[model samples]
Target chain A: MAYQFDFAPVLQHSDLLLTGAAFTLALTAVGAVLGIGLGIVGALCRAWKISPFDRLFGLYVEVIRNTPFLVQLFFIFFGLPSLGVKMTEWHAAVLAMVINLGAYSTEIIRAGIQATPRGQIEAASSLALTRLQTFRHVVLRPALTRVWPALVSQVIIVMLGSSVCSQIAAEELTFAANFIQSRNFRAFETYFVTTAMYFVMALLIRQLLMRLGQRFIVGRPR
Target chain B: MSLVKITGLHKHFGANHVLKGIDLEVAQGDVVALIGRSGSGKSTLLRTINGLETIDKGELVVDGAALHDGKGDLRALRQKVGMVFQQFNLFPHLTAGQNVMLAPTVVKSTSKREAEDIAKEMLLKVGLSDKFNSFPDQLSGGQQQRVAIARALAMKPKVLLCDEITSALDPELVNEVLAVVRQLASEGMTLIMVTHEMRFARDVGNKLIFMHQGRIHESGDPKTVFAAPQTPELAGFIGAVQEA
Candidate 1:
């Protein structure tokens, strides 16, 4: 039998697919803000290296980075229930995304912070700015500016990685595709359309984050 | 009384003794030039005065704030002593105006509007009125150096330390930066400069100091030291600078 492609059956559930896409977008947006925030803090803890945070964040980053995101998602979604800390599937997915992003970005932001020139620190100290003030104004901003492109790339990668949330049947775009295929029995058509949707999504998230970076960071000198 | 008084200042780096029992006094409005070959500790001496480098031994006081104890509250001393580096370390991500405004706003708690006004005035003083919004990479080496000077001046330091500020500039660019410094000198701002520019030292410094082997080998009026060459080390140093 000659195989024919049909997207009509999948398109029939447009409302379901659109809702799934929206959920995916929502998941990524929330994950990004929380993740990047966690990343900044982890990076600062590593950079400043104040006592317990030095060893703590270092170990945290190392552990999370060494482990696969899928395994971490499984541990959060499946493993945590045994420990008596229960959460919904959506919550677990967001938490996994956040934890993963934090570890990855810690190292990225640390590299940016380390590249700050010796002259800049000397200049800040000579001006009598406090250690906290120096990092907040002088050190952190340029560091972020330097590594912005890397940061944006990581954000999109995490967005794409959000597809794994479907493993727990969290009802993201991929889950919607699976549901449509199961209902219509057009497995090839459903999955192919879903893959294209993902491609479009990755591109959109990438452009949107880059635009945010431009508005807040690039070409606007402090 | 001298504005800056250092009696028996000593500094070490691991096993290396960089400054050996240095004794010097800088009066208010004195343009003092520290001249020596590399590794003579002239730069290190300037660094210690501004609390950038710690002293291994001796008393170092700048305008009533003593740093020899290593706990002498550098914050207060730093307000009165500003330093400009050889590298022209203007913050790369900030405009010249913002670079100048940072210290006052952050350290002194000046309002943003006030800091901006002061930054503009200092940039004007450095003769970079048109370059207030330009980033360091956008400007020439000379203009960047001038912005650095304006940044240092924005702190309103009583004694400005210049650590080979012009040594990093190209020959043509050196003069433009130096011209701004000379104006600061004539305007009665106290200056302690470590310089390789012998001609500038002879012309601008009211008092001259020569360092050799981590000690003040000779210190006197510029005309006397340049003409007489009291020590063979200084004479050799002058000869070396002339040939290069």
Candidate 2:
């Protein structure tokens, strides 16, 4: 018997798939921006020894890194409401993604910061650049450039992981695939198309990030 | 008048005493050459003047400004002094022009156009005017060091410290950097350079201070100091360099 593949059944309900893709993009874009911001702040606090902030962020990183991402998503989406912090499913999903990416990027960025040469810092301070100015202009950008590839990979991982949001009825790509499969009983066809979409998105994201790195991170033309 | 003064200065790392009870004065327009064996604390002494190294016990005053306690608020003092390292520590991410312009724009609040203008002028002075758009890695070792000099001079500091500036460069490239330093010295920049260039130090510097065992072994006019050594340590140092 031939294992006849069919994407026509999945392609017929294209609106649902497009809407789900849009939602995936929205969640990942917003989450990535906020998460990168959080990561930089967290990394700086830890790298510069901002006392309570360093210790607190270190604890956050350890807790998030050791646990399962699914568990973390559930805790934010399901557990927080019991503590009087209630949010909609979509809000919970975005918040969970941000927290997850933020922890991973904190360690990534901090390693970059630490690897910055001592002489560079000395030169900046010798020129009387304030500590904040030194970190912003001299330290942070080059550090990000050094570790950008790792950062991009982590972001894509988070994007693919968005599939888990279906568990909370977030109506992302996976949810649309499941909805189509349930409606038409085309499990293999629906999932195959969805997986291919994710692969394409991952490539698009890598290109976007590389362009960003060229424009902002490593400003040297060479 | 002396622009920099250090009295009874002492610095130690753990049980290792790096600078021991040193007293020195550098006047305006004076070029002081610090010459000694590698472990003689000459570099540590130069660094202490700029607050780059901690002084365990001493009084340091630069341009009549007091040394702030525990590295506090050296900003005012540092603004008056510029340092160039041996490795030519140009910020790799920035172009030659941006590297020179960074301190003035950020620390002194010079506008971008003005900073760029100054960077151009300084780079031109070091013969790197054409390399304003080049990255550090794109330039040769000597060109990079020249850019480093330009970066320091962009601050228009009253005093300049060169820590083995040309010691890292090739023999063929050394003169290009040394020429810039020579011009700075001739134009009356107060320079304190720790160098192994015996001939350049002898010919260029007005005063020579020989350090030995974390102490000033001898000090005098360069011609007299090298011609007539006051200590066997100074003689040995000069002999070793001559052989190398």
Candidate 3:
């Protein structure tokens, strides 16, 4: 007996797959924005050693980078309830994605910030720009422009990683894939489509981020 | 009237004692040149006047503000004193106009319209009126240094510091930058320069100070000093620079 390919069974569940994809994208949208924002603050602290937060964010990046994403999700979803902290599965999934991406983007952005030429800072200071002003006006955009590709890759990684949210019953794309496969007993077909969806999403997001970099970060002269 | 006064100035880089008990004075409208061998502390002394390098012991007064005590309003002092570097440190991410307009708009809160007008005027002065939108990397080193000069002048600084402003340019490119500095000097913009351009220093400087072993070994009118170096150190330095 040979494995027979069947499309009808998987096609019947298009509604579930679409909703699941929409959920995954929503989680990614929220995660990338907040995560990069958090990472910017973390990078500033780590790069400039901005007092108390430097040590705190340093510990955060180390811990999150060392641990597996699934464990972090479990800890947020399962372990936190034991300590009287309660959140929905959706909240836990989004929070885990944010923290994970935040740590990675922090390191990436800090590398960019640390690469800033020493003379640039001296020039800004000589022009009477204060430390904060220098960071905002002189140091930040170039740093972001340098690290944007890495940041975009990290975001895609987190989006794919969000598939693990299904284990916590978050009803994301992978959850729908699992639900469809279990009901119709069409494992191979369901997984094939799910994999394709993820591939397409990643490509689309990379294009979106590249356009964003050109428009806002690079701000290239016309 | 003296616009800058330094007395018993001292600076150290972890006991290197870069500048030792230096005393100097600059009057309004003076174009002073500092020339010396590398590691002789002439650059260190120039940096101290702008509060870029703090003094370990002594008094530095620029534009009526005391800077040595570490309590002076450094921003205010810097606003009144502009500096152009050998590297021409224009913000690479910004265009030439934005670079010139940055200080006036941000530090002084000049409106965008006013800042743009000032940038245009400064760029015109530097002969870069057409490069208002060019980024730093798009310009040659000489052009970048000229833009740096414009950026400094946009602040309307009472004094300008040039730290070997043309030293990083190619030999052929050096004169374009030097010409801008010469023009500024002729227009009575007080300038203190650390330079190796002997011809420039001789032609434009009203006073020339030669440093040796962390001290002003020779000081006088440029013509007098170059025509008859009072110290063997000055003679040797002039010889070495001229050979290069």
Candidate 4:
């Protein structure tokens, strides 16, 4: 017996895949924004070594980076509810993705921050700029420019990795693919289409981020 | 009272003591020159005055404030003392005018327009009125150092410190920067300079201090220090420079 190709069932439920992709993109977008916020704070915590808080933040980054994202998702979705912090599957997935991305971005941004020259910091100090002013004008701007390419690639990877959220029934693209496959018994066709959709989404996001980076950062060499 | 005073200053970077019990004083509006061979602690002494280098043991009083005793406000102390580095450490991202304007805007809380006006005036004084919009990389090294000087002066600091301000420039460019310093001294800007340029030291300095092995070997009027240095170390150091 040979496998029969079927397009009718898969095409009929195209709306389901589209909705799933919308959810996936939403999750990635929200997660990325939250992740970048957390990453900047974490990088500053590690960079400034601002007392006990810095060491505590370092521990948080280490644990997040070393563990698998799947396990982290399970901890947020399953483990947290038992501790009286109940969350929806979507919330859990988004939170988990944000935490994972934050850890990686912290290292990337910290490297950028450290790469700034000591002379620059001294000059800022001689100007008598307050700590906050120096960091905003001298350290953060240059650091962000230096690590922008790395940050973009990390965001794209997060977008692709969001497929893993389907394991928790988050109703994203991968979850929709599973549903379509089961209904039509057309596993290969459904998966193939879904994979192509993800590729296109990732490519679009990468291009957009690259354009943003070029416009804001590429020309401003400090 | 001395405008700036250092008494029993001591600093060590690990086992190498960079400043060993340095004592000096500068009256207001005085132009003092520190002359020494490399590694003789001339630069270290300058840095210590501004608290850029922490002292292991000492007292540094600037304009009646104790900088090393931990009793003074360091930020306020720095506002009173402006320093120009050998590398002309201007913020590369900012224009020359912006570089000069930054301290006033941020530290003194001057209005941006007022800061710009002051920056323009300082740039003009440094003979760089045409390079206000120029970045550090856009200017020649001599021009960059002049901007660095203007950047320091924009704070209206009572004291100006120069650490080999012309050492990194080309021979042709050195005179242009030295001229700016000379003009500042002529206007009574209260200057302390570390320099290898013996002729400029002799001409512009009211007082001269010679350092050898992390200590001031001799100090006096420019004529007395340069013509007949009292210490053997000072004489030997000057002899080596002359021979070179």
The ten-residue window of minimal lDDT in model 4 chain A covers A213-222
- Give one digit per residue, the lDDT tens place, for model 2 in B159-179: 999999998899999998999
Candidate 1 residues lying further than 4 Å off, grouped into runs, are none
Error of 1 at B105 (Å): 0.9
Model 3, residue A192: distance off in Å is 0.3
Instruction: Compute each candidate's TM-score over C-alphas.
Output: 0.96, 0.98, 0.97, 0.92
lDDT of 2 at B103: 96
lDDT, candidate 3, A45-87, per-residue tens: 9999998999999999999999999999999999999999999
Best-matching candidate per DockQ: 2
Q: What lDDT would each prediction earn against the true structure?
A: 0.90, 0.91, 0.93, 0.87
Candidates' RMSD to native: 1.7, 1.3, 1.3, 2.5
Q: Candidate 1 - CAPRI tier?
A: medium
Whichever of 1 and 2 has more DockQ, that candidate is 2
**C-alpha DockQ of every model:** 0.76, 0.84, 0.80, 0.48
As for candidate 4, its clashing pairs are none
In model 4, which runs have C-alpha deviations exceeding 4 angstroms? Answer: A1-14, A217-222, B68-71
